[model samples]
Target: MLRRFPTPLLVALCALTLTLVGTAPVSAAPTSAAPSNQARQLNQTILYYDSSRAAEYSSAVSSAVDVWNASVGNVRLEPAASGQHAEIRIITDDGWPRAHLGPVRPGGQVTVWMGRQGTAEGYDAVRIAAHELGHSLGLPDTKSGPCSSLMSGSTGGVNCTNAAPNASERSRVEANYGRGPAGESAADGRLLVDRR
Candidate 1:
């Protein structure tokens, strides 16, 4: 019962990565409703599936979020109903279509569509879940290296522990929120994806 994360990003620095590939134009984080310093980790909420592909594997997703919650002094989360409260949905397909993948709301909602469960096309549910939540929290893909970061453009496998957000990535999320706990730091992170 583990939420399988997406493909293991061929990370170099992070020891892991999560990437989603497509020819879509790179997106820029919207400059709205953030403090000037970009050092906030607002105590917001998140939503995701807790059953089937998603439910069967939440550990991975939880690991990634735990890192953000602890590192920054702004962002926080609470679980919502599987199909409600949050905006999580799955693509079933290997990768999220360009149209389906987009920016997430700050301190708003999160969704993961379980389009496909297993197979290469079927993105690791946990990894996708973790990466998508990062977006909702305000993190954006830098395409830093060809691989090695969860925020990469390609939906590569994510190294939950290694996928730890970098300074800029952390700032982006905190900027969206206010700040996380005072002295929180990243905890154990991991996810295992698979279909029933």
Candidate 2:
């Protein structure tokens, strides 16, 4: 029971339908598919460190910060602005290098003791600082790991002066900070005294 329209009329109707479809507004896709610009900005985790109390080890601490900043993308380490609170504090002492274990949040505090004992024993100062900082960033000692492992700490020996973290160590750090500020948890708080 189909009625045939004139060829010219049918062609015009088809063209009008195409135009209407082409001009129709599209519904927005789910935002979960891509994060908004502001959301991405909020997800960036930057931890400031205060090393003013580190005394003679300040240079080593700076070098350690540089190593970590270069190694990870999810987190960044920056020197605290004057008068600003810092999450990581570096100090020096005569004991073996150690740190308070933490996945320290922006306002949380953790200590990195740049012990002269390790340096006095001939361990590299920069390596010691970086290793202690690693503890603050939630890493534990892999005492049996080789010199290539930055978390290996003093067990790598005084001859193991590698200041940069190895691939595994870097990946661990990235994972730790990838969750951003909201994901931060209570600091481990246990003091890791690296006497060995």
Candidate 3:
């Protein structure tokens, strides 16, 4: 037996198939040329420190790096190679912990003094690390926020061991470095906040 679709019906079905196929969503196809949001994070903003005298705070510094690394998509802090020029230098002092606000470039330098004064006051070492590093990354001390905010610095009080930056703090870092390494060109030496 032989059967045939009517000419009009067959034409309509063909037209519908073509229309659907033509209007298919672009996301359905994988494109080799597309770049992903994560791919943009490949540009690592390396910062190194000696931390020789601040050996006691080594874990704190590492924890701070981990906190920032987890919070932002761009810019990573890495320990510098031995003898390599370091953009950020960390040392210890008798006073409160502090850092130079910087996008410090190579051949230039910034100092993060991990002072004992803050820890003596009962501030968390890890929070102190993150807060000082926050200054190094271009964030000013908020000082007014709660312990939940890392940038609040000493205002968070002695029990404030929260080393994580608040949402706005995280967003600012991402916005600053998310686009790429381009925004880091600002000249160094802004302000210093001693976690007092």
Candidate 4:
């Protein structure tokens, strides 16, 4: 038989769990020398955008991609050409912006929702796009981060229009996708629950 935790205890536990889930590193270093050129080529992860519903926010998507592309070199996100199979799909919806924890590897599917809710509240569209994409890239929300931290999500407040990933954020993504021993797994995706 088990007893339930008190309300306060439960809340605290939930907070801690959320923190750990969002902040813990999800990468493992390779056990041996790096793989051959062919293997390195195979490690590239490409994310395709649905682009239909997100048409209105194309600039935001492009800006977000530019931020990530400029920040890291291992992963490349491209617009899904017609009839192309997209590993990750992004669309616009009515709720708060969010993304599926993810497919993490190729041939898997993940969805990113670009909700108007955040924009309506004054959050920068590019930042929201990048923040949600960060989830797909295996980053969790650092709700306490200031405007400069891209993963800070909504906690940076509406004025945080900065869409660039900070140094640490950039390093983490590079570590996850950088060319190295062939077997390092990309971290799992984590949803950012709006605590505000």
Candidate 5:
């Protein structure tokens, strides 16, 4: 024969059991930590460019986009979809290449002028495209910097042709985009002309 506990005792035991279980520690699953690490990459800011008006410089623009995409993790550059308005516009002109400096936000507008003069003067087309795009990414001209620095522009000379951004330039672009869209400011809209 089994003995039955009093109703009051049974209730007390039930409450105690629930309290103990409720207070038990939970160890996080390994996967739970993965999202934090992946979040930044998953949230990478994307800026689109319209090269339709760039004319003969389209391939050069594409190559410059490739260089930037390979160098940074916080933002990505992609061709604008048909009928979609792009944040960056590439156009060809007879003058020197220039870009409206911007850490351009999504839906914002900035122009990159791919001037024929630069190519005519023997500067690498890819280098001119990359340098102008760098201005769109918020990089200023480091006119005195060596050829290894993509922002050095025409000062790197016609033979320079180094279309890749150096470590510091990459880091600055990464930091600019990492701040997300809300961090955008009017001051980022300066026009950078790549003369000389």
Candidate 6:
């Protein structure tokens, strides 16, 4: 439901979305300090790469996912598709939109365009991925940064990343959505992982 992309975003041809459909938690937060309406959402990590760069793209995804697993709640990257209903999936979309990045249903799927890997080398590192995921965690952007600061709008070559949501980031989302809901969920998405 929350959708806002900066001007001049990526121009991808094919992008996938992962949404979470769940009921409200049994122990809702006290009305005084919570977003009046709660939603069931999932977090998705997407990495678009060129077909030639596919081999090493996974290493990046794993590196990023590891960080999320250790700090964020317990959400895992759904396996690559095997013809079933996958919450997280990867597709060979000629060109997915690049501006597509944000929160998801914690265990939902995101299509990382494998077609745009090389362009990511000089820029877009684990930090960028983490920061984006932070958004999924319900954090917002600062529109500025120290370059290494993940919240900064400056893209690429800025390896600077700090996924530990800042006070403002944490307070803003939790203000609406409750504390991390059970991270246990399902996504129907094919992770472009381990493909040679």
- Model 6 — which ten-residue stretch has the worst lDDT? 12-21
TM-score per candidate, chains pooled: 0.47, 0.77, 0.76, 0.71, 0.80, 0.42
lDDT of 1 by residue, 117-147 (tens): 3324544444455555565554544453333
lDDT digits (tens) for residues 16-47 of candidate 4:
99999888765644534466655755766666
lDDT of 5 by residue, 1-196 (tens): 9999999999999999999988886665577888887997777889999999999999999999999999998889999999998999999999999899887878889999999989998899999999999988888899787899899888887799899999999998887787745345542788787878
Residue-level lDDT of model 6, residues 1-196, one tens digit each, is 9777654442231221111224445456576454432322243332222222234445544465566555433233434344444332322322321222333453343434433332244344455444544444434456555554445533323354443445554444343233443222222232222111
Report, for every candidate in turn, its global Cα lDDT versus the true structure: 0.45, 0.87, 0.77, 0.76, 0.88, 0.39
Residues 1-196 of candidate 3: C-alpha lDDT, one tens digit per residue: 8899899999999999999998989775576545664466555555665665566898888888899888876667777777887777777778878888865554568888889898888888999998888887778788677999888888887787899988998887765664546365673587585746
**Candidate 5: Cα lDDT at 92:** 99
* Model 1 misplaced regions, further than 4 Å: 1-53, 81-84, 87-110, 114-127, 144-148, 153-161, 179-196
lDDT of 1 at 38: 53
Candidate 1 vs candidate 4: the TM-score winner is 4
Residue 117 displacement in candidate 4 (angstroms): 0.4
Cα deviation of 127 in candidate 5 (Å)? 0.7
Question: What's the CA RMSD for each of the models?
Answer: 22.8, 8.0, 6.6, 19.4, 10.9, 22.4
**Higher-scoring candidate on TM-score, 5 or 6:** 5
Q: Highest TM-score: which candidate?
A: 5
Question: What TM-score does prediction 1 earn?
Answer: 0.47
RMSD of 3: 6.6
- Candidate 2 lDDT over 71-106, as tens digits, reads 877778989988999999999988889899987878
As for model 4, its CA RMSD to the true structure in angstroms is: 19.4
